[model samples]
Target: MNSIFKRTYSYWFLLPAAIIYFIIFILPTIMSFFFSMTRWTLSDWEFIGFENFITFFQEQSLSIGFKNTLIYAVVTCTLKVALGLLLGVLLTSKIRTKSYLRSVIFFPTLVSTIAVGIAFSMMMHPTQGVINTALAAIGIDGPDWLGDTRIALLSVAMVDVWKGLGFATVIYIAGILSIPAEYYEALQIDGGNSWHKFWNIIVPLSRPATNSVIILAFIGGLRSFDLVWAMTKGGPGFTTDLIASIIYKQYQGGFYGLATAGNVILFLVVTALAFPLYTYLNRKEVDL
Candidate 1:
């Protein structure tokens, strides 16, 4: 009876969370599949077979959105991993102002993203913005940031990396801290310098954290909407339009079914890529 009671209690402990997950995640996802096959509005929906998906793929904006989304995800994820690792090493180093510098670097992640977007928009303003103003002072011209199609996506991506790098750095710090100090002490005993310690000890032991950061950042970049929308609205002739932005525009235009289909596609793309990549990374981690 005591054993039975313990099992019951364990199940009860999990009940609330399981129910919440079903209600919030599983239910909505299942419903989305249904909605993706129908034309829907607030009060009404009608079955439309695969028409929504067909239209979504054929839409001109979607083509650009797909391309931009992939590019943005790849670029931002790479920079965040590379730069975050660098910053993590710096913060963990025995340097003056290390604690203060870590806080300063992390402050941007705590601020409101929309506020960051707006502030950066103004800062990158061609004529009077601080970035261009500095360039002008150096006798160089700054390109129109969000206004120019060529660089608008890259500009948004840079902001994303800035906003997210701190979180990645924190993750790396945790990973690095978890490493046994004996490893570093041994390296020191071997007369290894800082660069040698980093290359041989820190990099090898931090694989798990790197994998986590890469997957999370890549997924976030793929689904990014708010900052891009606030900064460019996928504008300057659809140059910066990501998949999420395109879906949002469709929803705004009352193409409910098509928007649902777009969401479905986004879900599939993220899941498909993320799962395989996660498995590969975990395998590599085990090998490490």
Candidate 2:
């Protein structure tokens, strides 16, 4: 009886957090699922089955949004992983200004996302922006960064990568630094070059960090909104439309239920993709 009481007392400490999580996350998620199946106003809703989802799929820009989301996720994840790994390796090396450089690289991450977006939006202006002005000085006419349909999505994606690269690098740095020195010493004794050591030891051993960066960046890219919105807002005739932006457009058009359905879809996409990738990465980590 006493042991059971003690366990119960211990669980009581978790009640506050549990209740908060249920209220904030679980309750809202459950309500979203229900609302997605209904035609809703702020005050009332009518049961409409899966009409919202059907309408969302029937949206003309759905295909574009879906494709852009996948592309953005892939490109950002690849860049972040590759660049983060390289930066982590260099920063961890015996460099004189490594500390200062690390701070400089990570500084942008501390800035607000919206602020970054707005600033870059201005900087990327065709004629008046700093980027084009500099290019003009070098006798080149710079294309409009955010105005071009062809590269607008890619432009916004590059900004996202720039903002996120620091975080990925920091993660990789931690992972790289955590590696025991004995491994490197062993490689040295075996007369292994930097390339050999990096491939055989550092790369394989840092799988966990790499996996973390990949999943995070990929998910972030898929659900990207604020940066895209601040820069392009799915502009140039929906050329830069992403899933999140499409959902927001539904809300802006007063299709609350439809937007909710889109949210549910986004949730499912994240869960489905993240779960399998996480599982695969975990297995790889274990194998390593």
Give lDDT tens digits, candidate 2, residues 71-183: 89999999999999999999999999999989989999899889999999999999999999999999999999988889998999899989999999999999999888988
Native RMSD of candidate 2 (Å): 1.8
Candidate 1, which ten residues in sequence have the lowest lDDT sum? Answer: 279-288
lDDT of each: 0.90, 0.90
Per-candidate TM vs. native? 0.93, 0.93
Predicted structure 2: lDDT: 0.90
Model 1 C-alpha lDDT per residue in residues 169-287, reported as the tens digit of each score = 99999888888899889998999998999899999899999999999999999999999988888888899998898889999999888888889989988999899999999989933
